[model samples]
Target chain A: MADHTATSGTNRKVCVEHLFKVFGADPADTIRRIREGAPKDRIYAETASVAAVADVSFSVAPGEIFVVMGLSGSGKSTLIRCLNRLIEPTEGRILIDGEDIVGLSADALRRLRLNKLSMVFQHFALFPHKSVGENVEYGLKVRGMAARERREKALRALEQVGLAAHADVPPANLSGGMQQRVGLARGLAVDPEIMLMDEPFSALDPLIRRDMQDELLKLQQQLRMTIIFITHDLHEALRLGDRIAIMKDGRFVQLGTPEEIVAHPADDYVAAFTRDVDRSRVFRAQSLCRDAHALSADEDAGVAAERCEALGREALFVVDAERRPLGIVRHRDLERDATATPGDALITDFPSTRGDAELVTLYGACATGLPIALLDDAGRLEGVVEPLEVFHWLGGTGAEGGGAASSGGEGEATPASAAPSETRRRDHG
Target chain B: MADRISDFYTLPLDDWIEVVVKEWLVPNFRPVFRAVQWPIDQVLGGLEEFLLWLPYPVFVVVVPLIAWRVAGGGVALFTLLSLLFIDLLGIWRETMVTLAMILTAVTFCVLVGVPLGILAARSDRFAGLIRPVLDIMQTIPPFVYLVPIVMLFGVGIVPGVIATIIFALPPVIRLTNLGIRQVQAELVEAGLAFGSTRRQLLFEIQIPLALRTIMAGLNQTLMLSLSMVVIAALIGAGGLGLTVFTGLGRLDIGRATLGGIGIVLLAIMLDRITQALGEGRHAQRPGLKESLTRWLKGLVQGSKAYNERR
Candidate 1:
């Protein structure tokens, strides 16, 4: 168990290995078929069982936010519940703090849930008969906490979620968002090291959903608990995930940071997800940066002009000896200043952006038509970001426009849509 | 031809049952029945004598006060007028005896039924096993079993109370089972997830949520007990039921009418009070004793919270 690192280090807070949950009378044959790589439909046709969760494995680092993103029925919720042993796995090893919780005695599992882990449900499972305070105090009460201490702790937890005044109110009186806050407070009251949030905000309206997301981010920053959040919304996943694992038909299609997923989706399914994403918000200037070939201010302009023509580049950043961008030297200007130095051909006051600026903010910078000089923190030139290259990277729909459609006619649509973006990149590369 | 057709199919079901029950079941179970009867008689007799010992006006006043506390002013006034009318008819002793018998039967029903109901709720196999038995118990006419109970335990208030208990027990058990089962599954899961023991989860979460349903079951049990207690008077249980029985035997219309009025008034009053308590309306006013106990609980709670903060 110690030797088997799920996907990362042995120090991981949660590790799930080869988990399988088949929903039917005879799971053994179906599981065997699944293990041999038979797809869900074929296995269901043969064995009369739905493999709700297939052979899935991932580990969450201590204090890391791991989001499992998938559509409904994709087994994301089932997979997370498997971690806490809420849904008993038909086959797997779930190691929480290096202890295999799947094999724990009932008492030990209860203790783990009480002291080490907590969960938030999608529908906010607050006790209808209990007040918000009592709901929060539930874990403490189960642990045999003194009534007063539990009350104090519950109040403190409520205060953390900005619902202190509502401690005595029944959960039914609160709206959906507030009720979810109560659920969060209940989970928080226990002070568990890990929180299994199963689509905690999915039941709210869009406005409340966004508000709750911000509140969760704030809470996570202060608490730093390892969170395994499940959601079907790609936008929510991108917003909250430090690292996301995209699930499809009970298997992870890809796992990476949000930027990595948006910029380089692994397949057609992932690219289909990317098409709906607001690309400007997801990609930063660094993602679109190209290597900036700079001419030194002292370099001769006739040579600069020929170099630009040979390279088929439209412009160059005129930089000092220290490589700090002074200004752009357009190809036309360089040609006009035949014997003059590159500095004499320089067109100063070009629009520039910091490497960390989002592409959305850099659109106006790109409107100036000269290459946008991408600078690092100390104002040194990192790269030149041309508007056309930015458009190509943003407009093209990831791997779908490339390798995924390799099967003849399917490839036709891929290249046809990619044609315009590719032309733009070529014209401006 | 018709006579032959009717006679040809006669099965002697009555003779066979009579022989089996009277010759076999009664002889074997008689001692067990007698042993159980001793306690029921003692409890019923003691309660009846105590209620008889209370002066009529005092009894009327105390009962109405209890009614007022449980069901509010209007029901209490109704109870007062009803009891005064029963006293005016000079059948207060019989009314007291009837009340005692009904109380004892309902109490025994609750004590036996609730735990069995909980057991049924907790296990599918147990519930399945009990379902057919409860169905048979509920479906059998009460008078049919009263004869067998009298045969085993002999005719008296003891046998009467025993029969009343049997007739009343089914509803409480069925309702308790239904109530526990009706508790939201999510709440039970929450309780288990928070480390509550099986017992704690049952008492703290399931029971509290199912409280209203369980109370409704209790109210049904109480009403059934009252009905059965009156019917038990035929076996010499002696109460307002005996008064009505004796009055009807002599064809004395006025006496029977007065006894009938007493039963209706008692039934309505008891039903309303229990139902009110079940609905949690009785908690609207805390008596001095209850308030004192609550204050003490508050103190303990406060100190515990203070210590926890430290």
Candidate 2:
């Protein structure tokens, strides 16, 4: 496994390129029509075929949680299954740690699955006859590990999921949440470098679903496993995905960070999905922050007041030599002490927050009606979250177009659709 | 109109069947039929000798003990009393021989049927090929094949057992196929996703879950074999079946009734035990000692109540 990783100069854990999975009698003809840009419905009408996945491509870096979100029939499940060749793709390449697995022999594919990748299913498919420990150890057993060693490793994996106590019990005896934990333990036991999860929490109750999501995040933090999570829940995608790809009709509509997606949805379908999302929870301070206007700490208070008045701002940020925020200098204070340096009258107690803080958490800081300094690591002023900007983002107004246009340039590293605004306009009409 | 319809050239279906069976099958398949009978003969001979050699007291104790373990005290008592009555009827040897035949047929049925069932469950083409064959084997009257069987293998115990096996084989195969196929597709996918080989998937996941259904098939096989015994007796197979066959030939109603009674007793005992096994109740049943203690306590209490009533 390490040798494969070493051979792959790129750091991507898994990469799929131009993958297509057409379910029909004539996949070649259907694929040809699909490549010719025929609509899925027309293709189906013409060839009597369903293109479950079409021209899909994305790469997940090591330790990144790449989420593919779509509703039923959007082909998210097919796309995930293609990663393991469970449903063999009709076209293109799937490179795992730089090794193209699309052409792997059956035995080689099995070995790859045993050593490098493990899948967690939507239904928590624990073998009913096996004990929880046995279920967890199934992958290791398939890998031909010694029985005692596999059992020990299985127990350890179960312990990681807080299910060590239930190891000896049959999986049927566990509650839904506990059974999914065993499913998770089963995946974990193999210690796969990449874990493919197909809506692992979707079958769970709402409350348990949230708990499982948190559990998965916590596990990912420790394990740093490259996870490609599939879900139909937009909220779940936003909560768990470091980068999210929204799919429709077997094609990806947009791919970006949760904040980017919530702030600047690429098309109307994506916009409609984002419309229901709680922006305060998804859009962080960094995404909402505006570039702060600051004066050097040694600048004159009179000059600062003049600069603030010229800019029509209520206050100005004061920064030291490294661009680290010293404090804010209010216009009134600068005017009151016009003879002194701006730093002398700086309000050191002004509200501030980290750039990564969610907008929900900055409501109190925003309540001060002052620009909240958004600091990055080392106390540098990355940007400022203005009170108006918070309301603008939370209000779901049309002011998002400018933000969307600005982030659109940097949001995707892949060759995503270029005419998002055009598509959005067309959809709106 | 009916005479005209009948006057249309008659297809000689019966003559064709006779030519196929007598001239073609008997001459060509005699060796194959003998080979088929070889395993049945060995198993039947061994079982019959052991059952005959075992003391009556030990057989009486052991069979009821098995029933007690598998079922409950009521079944155990029924088994014990039935076997003792068969002995009192002076047909214990005949009963053992019939039991041996039934056991041997069922054994062969499982060995042949299970792999075929697994194959049917795995492949649609194989299943399609075998489905009509299984249907014919099941729906055709048992007596229809006896002549062909006797022509091929001759009149003897092995041929009789072979006929019983053919009559009993379909249920096990059909049920085994249904059981394995009915195992949830998700479980099979899980097995594959976890990198289990096809063999491992069948044994580790499919067979274990399908065991109860397979056991139901076994019980059906046993019952069908029991029903075939009297028919098998027409071919000179020795057992209680012989007793019934001879009594029927001579119009000895008393002898026929006694033989029928003995067969029914044996059938009831075996059916109860196998059915209990199929239901998987054996795992939850109380131990024999615990059941005996509880029964004794119930008997004592019953006597006290009876005395008070008197």
Candidate 3:
């Protein structure tokens, strides 16, 4: 009996307000009590409540990445489950579009989940007895999709996730990453409006996690579906979230863009959380450079000097003949040598990063205050190293590194630089 | 060879416990249960229950209903023919009495076993504690259990039911524990996260999810009860089983065969229906049917809109 009743201002899809769920003893009765204003402590005392999810509320815009992050028990998973009433709320209301879904019948809620919302479980929850195609078509079968249509849709979904090749295989035969892709395809098969992922890639090796993230980004770009992604990995959250909500003890401690969260953390918990973050790796140089005009690449020194003399524009990107970035030549780096030509004293700094590397590794790499080079395939540079620019991007005091930023030494551009490799094995006892 | 065959069929516990444990226990816990038990328990349980309950009246109604639901009208019609053959042999009344005996015995089993199952499921220690007893209950020959039941409860349907409860209760209890334990841990967590009271989680998610397995146990119990109910007729229970036993004593193959037919009919029906209901994944998923089901008086304001929109 989900209230499908339309109201002018309320969202018609799904809304959950101040929902609380406690296990043991007629949970619906607990919700009834809570609506009537039962104290949480008393509710706990009476029902042996675990307080899985406390009063947590966040709206998902139509096409944004809203991530919920927390440790294993933080109730982030519970909160997401509450959205579709897959997990019923002990207290409060969930509105879908504009409908209060808390009271939805199991079938209605399942239909809603099937038609409008799809979730990927941490364990993948693929029916072990079903083939990949059958698993993907489960919701369609439940929705009464004809065999041909559902098969076509399932195959299409598999294709989107690059798993059409494994359509007939049992899910268990595949690796964790492949299984997760199958899970992703399963979630996408129904063409759900909101895709809810419960730590979908947490089980994958680091390398696979990044690939899956990119794959998800690509899908999100194509589908423009609102995504509520859950993860405990901070970097994963920052990598994918348009906005992230950090949760603890069944409560959201902070909610903001990764930039705001990294620079001005709400409190001690958030500050401690972001203590080791490498601002350079995460923040873009364009968003950071205070004197963009002064950074003249030595390769472009003559051109910049001509511009500065004429139009007072002091900086320019130093580049090779093919427009590959070497580094930035400040007025000083150029003035230090009168013999310096844009050719003779070309800035040797190579391109640094896409500014989306994992902050933990980037922090370690940036400790020497070196601007790590960013490169595309074929080893060509795109921009100057901006490791020092990260501190400024973080909105810390605009202090340049005390030493000259080192140009990136020769290093193989491996997936390791992005995230841990999928095949990165550890000895198990 | 004749002596050895007779003795083999009736070996005492001294010669049997090791065989039971080796043949039943180890494989059921480890590598392959069905593979091991196909030649033993399941086959034995099926054959024994069939032999004991096949000719009873309860089997008649049950077999057709089950056939109707699962195997469809053709099977139902086929099933009815086999049953009326027993009645044409004129053991219908006695078969009805045997059905009563099995139903009574099963009622007693459920009464004692369900709570025990629930208790064991709720407590690890209790479940562990019952493991040995359940195993022993399943392994010991039916006669050993009957002797004590007869001494304590006296001879009749009451004593028979008591003995049947002792024999059949373990499967239901064991399966209940197994079912509850088998419920996905995440579904329980979902229940908890949903603010489901522990009770609600147990009743709604845990119990419902565990139902198929639990139903399997119930089916086993019903089967065991029906099987044992006829044997209990030996001690003056006088059901369809009594007719079969009596016919056997008088060497009247017609009467014995008719009685056997009745019990088989009942077993088939009850087995089919319970399994059909238990295996149902969709039957229980609640939703639009309620929207379709006209509520008394009228649809709620919320429901009315749901209907209009749909």
Model 1: colliding residue pairs:
A148-B305
> In model 3, which regions exceed 4 Å deviation?
A1-50, A90-93, A103-108, A291-388, A391-429, B1-181, B185-223, B235-310
For candidate 2, lDDT tens digit of each residue in A1-429? Answer: 434555444888888889999999999999899889999999988788999999998888888889999999999999998998888999988888888999999989888888888989999989876789999999999788999999999999999999899987778888999999999999999998999999999999999999898888888777889999999999999888878999999999999877678767898999999988887787666665566778888788778998989867788799889999888988888777678888678788888987556678888888887899978668888767677767777877723753553246334212112212111111111
Share of reference contacts kept by candidate 2: 0.70
lDDT of 2 at A159: 96
TM-score versus the correct structure, for each prediction: 0.83, 0.89, 0.53
Instruction: Report the Cα interface RMSD of each model, rounded to 1 decimal.
Output: 2.1, 1.9, 8.0
DockQ of each: 0.45, 0.48, 0.04
User: Model 3 over residues B80-165: C-alpha lDDT tens digits?
Assistant: 88668756767666665666656655665666777788889999999899999999999998878776455444576556656766
Model 1 misplaced stretches (Cα beyond 4 Å): A1-8, A36-48, A260-273, A289-358, A369-385, A398-429, B1-70, B281-310
Cα-based lDDT at residue A88, candidate 2: 91
In candidate 3 the C-alpha lDDT for residue B172 amounts to: 89
lDDT of 3 by residue, A244-316 (tens): 8898767788987765566557888877777776564444432222222233234345555665465333334
TM-score: the better of candidates 2 and 3:
2
Winner by TM-score:
2
Please give me the DockQ of candidate 2 compared with the native complex.
0.48
Candidate 2 wrongly placed segments (more than 4 Å) = A1-9, A321-323, A398-429, B1-24, B281-310
> How far in Å is the alpha carbon of B101 misplaced in model 2?
0.8
